[model samples]
Target: QPANKVFPHFVPSLSGFSLTSEVKTQDVEYDVPKANSTDGKDEVLFGAEKGWLGTPIDELNRMPQCAPPLSHLKVVPNHTVTVRTDLLREGEVPVPYPTKFKDAWDDVSVKMPCSEKNLFPMETEDGGGVQSRWELIHTALQGGFKKRSHLTILLLQCLFFPTLSSLQCLELCEAQHLFEVVLPAMVSLALSAPRLCTLPIPLLKSRMNHSLTMSQEQIACLLANAFFCTFPRRNSRKSEYCNYPEINFYRLFEGSSSRKIEKLKTLLCYFRRVSQIRPKGLVTFTRQMVNNPPNWESSQTQLTRLHITCEGTIEDDGYGMLQVDFANRFVGGGVTGHGLVQEEIRFLINPELIVSRLFTEAMEYNECLIITGTEQYSKYSGYAESYKWKESHTDETDDWQRRCTEIVAIDALKFRHFLEQFLPEKMVRELNKAYCGFFRSNTNSKHLSAVATGNWGCGAFGGDTRLKALIQLMAAAEAGRDMAYFTFGDAQLMRDVHEIHTFLTGRKVTVGRLYSLLNQYSSTVCKNCRTTRPDESLYSFIYQKVSSQTATDALKVISDGTDTKNLW
Candidate 1:
C-alpha cells in the first residue's frame, strides 16, 4: 500500500486567502522568439560601429543558419545577417509570450504570430487568446542565469511585485517610508485579516483615519509599471581603441528609462513582507520559497555555448605580427540549449518546491542538474526513480539524466579533423604563399606563419576540444567564402554539439524535396592533392576543368542537418 494512501497529505488553510487560488485577471504582453507567420515591412539597417536597431526583429533582416565553410575559406556575415543575443536556433521552437500590446512599447506591436521581436503586447488577433502576464512574468522569472535565480527573481520583483509578507528569504522593511499615506492602510488591512502577518501595522492605523481604495494586486502592478527602470553600463574606452564603442550586453535595461538602477533596487523591498513585528522594536520575516530542500544533485546542470569570433594573432614570419589585439567583449549569443527549463524559471520555486521541480523538470528534459535541489531529493530518497537507480526499466527521464552529464563534457577531436581539410598539400609552402602577412595566434610558430594564434586564455570553464576545432575552422574559414558547408553523419552528436551545426548548418534554410540542399565553397579542391582553388565556381565541370582537378567525388560531409539551404 502507498504511504500517501494511508496517511493522506495535510492540506494548508486557504480560508484566510492564498495567492495560489486567487483569480485576478492577468495582463498579457511579451512575445516569444521567431513566431511571426505573415511578413511585415522590413527595415534596411546600416552597418556602423554599433549594431542595427529596428522595430521588429522577426521580419526585418532576420538571419538563417548556414553551412560552415571549409577551414581555408573565411566565413563572413552579409547585409542580410542579423545576430542578436535573443537568437532562435534549429530544433528550438518559439512560443509567444501572451501579453497585450497596450502593455508596452511604442513603435511595434504584436498581432497574429509573434516572437521576442516586438515589445507592445496586445490581445491575440486569433481572438479568445489564452495569453497571460503571469505566464510571461513567471516564465522569464524561472530562467536562471549562471545558475543564479536570485538575480532574475530580484529583477522581476523590482519590476512587477509590490508589498507581500515575505519572498523566499528577503526581509520586508516595515519602518514605514510613507508614514502618513501607508500607516492607516496597513492597520485597516490587518484588522480585516488578523491571520495576515504581512500588513504593516502603521499602515492599518492610517487606513482607519483615511480611505484607501486600491487592492494589493492593483497597487503593486501600478507601482511596478510607474517605476520601470534600467541600469546600463557606460560605453568603455576599449571601443575607442578599436573600430567601435565598447558595449556591454548583459546590463539590465527597463524600457526607455536606462538610468534608474538604485531606485529599482529600493523598490524590491516592497515585495517582501515581515512575518512578525515586536512591540519593543523587533521585526520577524518568513521565507516564501519552493518546498524543496537544497542539495548537491538538484542544482547541477550542463551548458553549451556556441561562440563564433575572429581568431589570428599579432605575430607572423612575413609581416612581423598580425597585430589584432583581442578583448573579451562578450557578444553574439545563440540559444544553444532548451530555453525554458534550462533558463530562468528555476529561480521562482518556493523553497520547499525547488527540489521536486528540479528533479521533475530534469526528468522531463532527460537531464538532471547537479543542483542542491536535485541532490537533496536524491540523497533523501536514495535515487529510487533515477535512471542511474537501474533496477527498473529506463524511462526517458533516467536516460536523459544519465546522458546530460556525459553530453556536457567536451570532445577535442571532431572539429580538428574538419580543420585538416583546409591545410595545403605542402604545409610550409602554403603558409609562405597563401596566408596574409597577418595571423591571429602563434603559440606554435614553427608550423603556421600566421600571427595572433597564441592563446590569450581568459575563459574559466573547461574546453571542449571539438568546440575548439569548430572555432578553428570558423576562424580560418572566414576570409574568402560568402558561404560554407560542413557535412557529417546524421546523428544527435552531429546536432547537440551546437556550435558546429549552428554556424555550419542552422539558419539560412529552405526545405526542399528529399534531395538535401547544396553547399557552395566558392572554389574547388583537388581530390588527389586536396588543393583548394581560390576562384569561385557554380558547377563541378567548370571548377575542375579550369582548376585542372581530378574527378574524385569525395564525400561532402555536411555537418548541417539534411533540412537546410543558404544563399551566399
Candidate 2:
C-alpha cells in the first residue's frame, strides 16, 4: 500500500523538504507578557513571561465546589467517616465542630491506632518492662518525652531497627528532633483523628468525578495517622488496598540509605512546621474523568500561546499556573518506598498531597487528579540519589478559596520496549490522557490558566521528549489554554520546541492537522525497527512537512476528516 493510502490526506508534496515563501524562517519575536502586579499595575520583570509570581491566582477560575458542605455532616453508605458525629450535633440540628473529639472505632470508621482497644502490650529489653501502644502514645501526648523514653526507644525500634538487627539510621541530633519535636506534634495531631475526619470521605474511584475537601488540620491528622502506621489493610499487596497506593510511613522509615534519611528530614521538617502553627485554609482533591474523549484527528482547535524556557522548575517558576505532576498510575508512586522521582518529590515537598493515595485508586488512561490549595513547606535541591533537603519554605502565595496551589496528576504509559511508544494507539492514548488533565469547562474557559508542565513521561518511562511535548501542546490547545513548558535546563530543547511552536503558530496550524501528521509519523517510525534517528525525528519530520507544505495542503488533511478505522 502507498504511504498516503495508509494515512490518507497526510502525504507531503513530492517537491521535498524546504522552507518555502509561505513559511517564514526569520527569528520570530516571542511575546513576553507581563504579570498582573500586586499594586494594581502590570509589572514586567527583566525576563518575565506568562507564568510569573505577580500574576494573581484569584483572577483565574473560581474554586471547585466542595462536597458535604463544611457546615453539615453526611456519611454515605459503605464509606468510612473517621470523626465522631454525635459530638457535632446541637439540639437535633447538625453543626460542624471539627475540634470536638470522641473515640468511635466501629465498623464504619477508620480504625484508630491510638485507641486503647487496638493497642497491645510489648515487652522491654530489661526482661520485665512492658508498655502498651496506647500508654506510649498517651505519654507522648502528655509531653512526658525524655532523652531515652520508652516511646522514643519504641519508635527507633520500629523505624531504624525493624528487624531488630540493622544498624541505627538516625544521627544524635536527628533522633533528638524526632523525639522532642516531630513525635510530639505527630502524636498531638493523631489525637484529633476522631474530630478531624467528620464525614466519610468518598473514595476517588477509577471512573468517577468526585471531589474531597477538608481543612489543612484534617489532612494533618490523617498524615499523622499514616506516620504512626495506623491506617488498616494498607501494608500488604494482598489486602483490600491492593488497588490503592501505600499510605503507611513504614517503608520510608524501614530503609537505611542516605536518600531515605534525607527524605525523612524533609518529612520531619513538615511535622515541626505544622506543629508550630496548623494551617487553617482548605485543600481539595478532585478526580476528573472524561466520558467522551476528543476526536484527535478531526478537531480543528488552534495552538494556544506558549512560554518555553530552559531555566526553573515546575514548582518554582510555574506558580500561578496549573502545574502538572508527572505521576505513576498508583498516584504517589514510591514516596512510601525508596522511589523518589518527579511525582514523589512533589509529594514530599507538599506532604498534604500524599493523603490522596489513601482514597485515589490506580488511575485510568482517561482520568486525572487535580489537587488545589496545597502549600509547599520544604525546599530541596538535586534530583534522585543526590537529593538533599534544604531549609523550610514559607509559602507566601495568595489563596483562591483558601487554596494556594493547583496541581494535576497525570500518569503516562510506561513502555518496556522503546519502540512501543511509536505505535499510533500509544500516541493517541497519551494525547487523550493529556487532554483529560488539561480540559476545562466552557464556563471556566475565560479563566482557563496556562498549563505549567515539562518532559512528562520522558525519563524512566522511555518516552521521547519531543513527542511528549508536542502531545501536551496539542492537548492544551484543544482544551483552549496556553502553556508554560519548563525544559528543566535543556536549552537546546527549549529553543527547538519554541522554534517549532513559533513556526506552527505563525502558519496558523490547527490541532487536527498536527494530529494527522503525528499519526503519519508514528506509522513511519513503527515500520522501521530502529529508534528515531536525528534526521527522522518527530521534530525534524514536522519541520520538513509543515514548512514545505502549503496552508491548503494542511487544510485538506483536516477537511478530508479522520479515518475512523485508524482512530484509537
Candidate 3:
C-alpha cells in the first residue's frame, strides 16, 4: 500500500472546510506511463499501449475483475469489553438496555475517570427547576415522547447519565421494575466522571492508510460519549474541532417534532442493543482511490454490461459486493439537517459508518470513500424524507473477520446551474470520480463485483439521469466492473437507460465511441438550446442517432476488428 506520486495529497484549506487542491490516492501506488498529449488538442485513443492521445492508460488486463475472498483479508476488531444484549425485541417501540448495562459500565469505569462536578446545571432559568442529572433527563423526556415511552427515558439515562438512579427517577420510569437492576451500577459510573468520553488517541489520528477497524463496543462507546455531550469543545462552533463533522447529540435535542422523536428512538434503540451485547467481528472505515486514474477522454473500455432495475436498494441489490454511496464531500450528507437521501439512509442503518466523519476530511472531486465491515444495526423502508428506521437485526460476519458489507462513498459534483454539468470538463471530472470509487482492489488484485448505484446525483444535485447513468456506466467499465443500477422507482429513467444500453450493446459500442458521442452530443445540445431545455434528453438524442439506418451503416463500415479508426 504505497502512495501514488502522481496524485499527491492536497492539504486542507485555511478555513479547514474545503479542499484546496486535487485529491491524492491513499495507501496505493502503481506504475503508469507518461503521455505527451496536451489538453483538448491531443487525439484520444483506446486500448493503445502508446497511450490514448498522450493520456496514459494503465493495462486493464492485469487488474482483477473480482475481489479476493474475504478469508484472505485481515480485519481485526479493536479490543474492548463487549456488552451483550440480544434479548431485546425490535418493533416500533424502543427498548431499554439489558440489566447488565450497569455491571458493564462499572467494569470499564475502573480504567476511566468520573466527574467531580455536576454534569448538568442544577436549574434552568426558563423551565421548572431541576435538581439532579436524573431530573433533567426526566424533564426532557416528559414532553410527550410516546414512541417507546418508559424504555426511552430509561435508555436516555443510561446513555447520558450512566450513574443516575432509576429509583430516584422512579416517576420518570413508568415501569420501575424494568430498570431497577441496571440503575445502581449506571449511577456509579456517571457520578465518577464529568470529563469528555473520548476515543483512544491512536484511533483518532488521520493516517495514510486511512483505514480504522473498531469493535461494536468501541463504536458504542464513541457514540455514547457523543450522547452525553462529553467530547470536550465539540459543542462550540468556534472550537478547533468544529472543522470536524458534528459528532455530539445536541442536534437531536433541538426540536420536538414526532419525526425528530422517532429519529431519537431509532438511535437509542441501537445504543440499547450495543450497551447490552458485544457484537462479534469488526467494522473498517477505509478511504480508497484509483492510484493512477485514467483520463476518461482516452479510455477505450467498453460499457461493462449492466443490470438496470427500477426496484431495490443499493445495499440489497449489491449484497456481498461493493455498494456505492452518493455521498457529500463531508460525508453523511445532512444527517444533522433536514435533508435525507441515500447517504442519510445508509448512515441511519449502519450508524457506525457515521463515526468516519470524526476524522474524514472534506473530499475533493477525485476523492472517494470505502468503508468495509460496517454492521447494519437497523432496517428501513422508504426513500428520502419518508425513510423510517424499522426493526433490529444482526449483520453476519464474513470469513475474514469482517462484516458482510462494503460501502464506498463517491460524492458527485453539485451543480448550481443545470447546464454547467453538460460541460465536457465537468463530465470528465465526474468520470474520474466515479472511476476512482468504482475501481476496487489494487494493480495486482481485483474485486470484480458489479457496482450497485442509480439516480446518484440526479436528486438533490440536479444531474441529468441519462447523462449521469452513462457516466457511471463508462466509469464502471473503465474500472473493469459491471454495474447493477437501481433506478429507485424512476420508470422513465429505467426505460431510457435500458433502451440506450441495449442499442449501445447491440452495436458493440466501445466506451471510447460513447464518450466521443457524449462529447459531440453535449456540444450539440448546448448549441441547440442556449437556454436550459428539459425536452432534449441525452437518451433521446443517442437513441435517434444510433438507431438511424445511416448510423448503423456507418458503424458497420467503421467496424475493423479492435481498431475503429473513425471515432466520429
- lDDT of each residue in 1-568, candidate 1, tens digit only: 1211100111112121111212243332222122111122332322222121222222211011111221221113211111111332222221111222223222111111112221334567675444443334334433433222444454555344332212222212222222222322322322222121122111111001111111222222222322221111112334211221212112223321211221121122232221112111111111111122112122221111121112111111112212121111111011111111111111111111121110011111111111111100110101111111001011111111110000010011112333242333222222221122122122232322122221211122222333333333233332221111111121222222222233223222211100011111212333323433323322333333422322121112234333223222
Q: Summarize candidate 3's per-residue lDDT along 344-401 as a digit string, tens digits.
A: 7788778888777655666766677788778776666555645555556676655434
TM-score leaderboard ranking: 2, 3, 1
Worst 10 residues of 2 by lDDT: 1-10
Q: After superposing candidate 3 on the true structure, give the runs of residues whose Cα lies further than 4 Å from its correct spot.
A: 1-67, 70-209, 443-446, 547-568
RMSD of each: 27.2, 14.5, 16.1
Candidate number with greatest lDDT: 2
Write down the lDDT that model 2 would get.
0.68
lDDT of each: 0.21, 0.68, 0.56
lDDT of 2 by residue, 342-442 (tens): 89899999999999988899999899999887888878777898676665676642322344578999999998776678688999999999999998665
Q: How close is candidate 2 to the true structure, as a TM-score?
A: 0.75
Q: lDDT of candidate 1?
A: 0.21
The candidate, 1 or 2, that scores higher on lDDT is 2
Ranking by lDDT: 2, 3, 1
Off by over 4 Å in 2: 1-177, 396-401, 530-535, 551-568
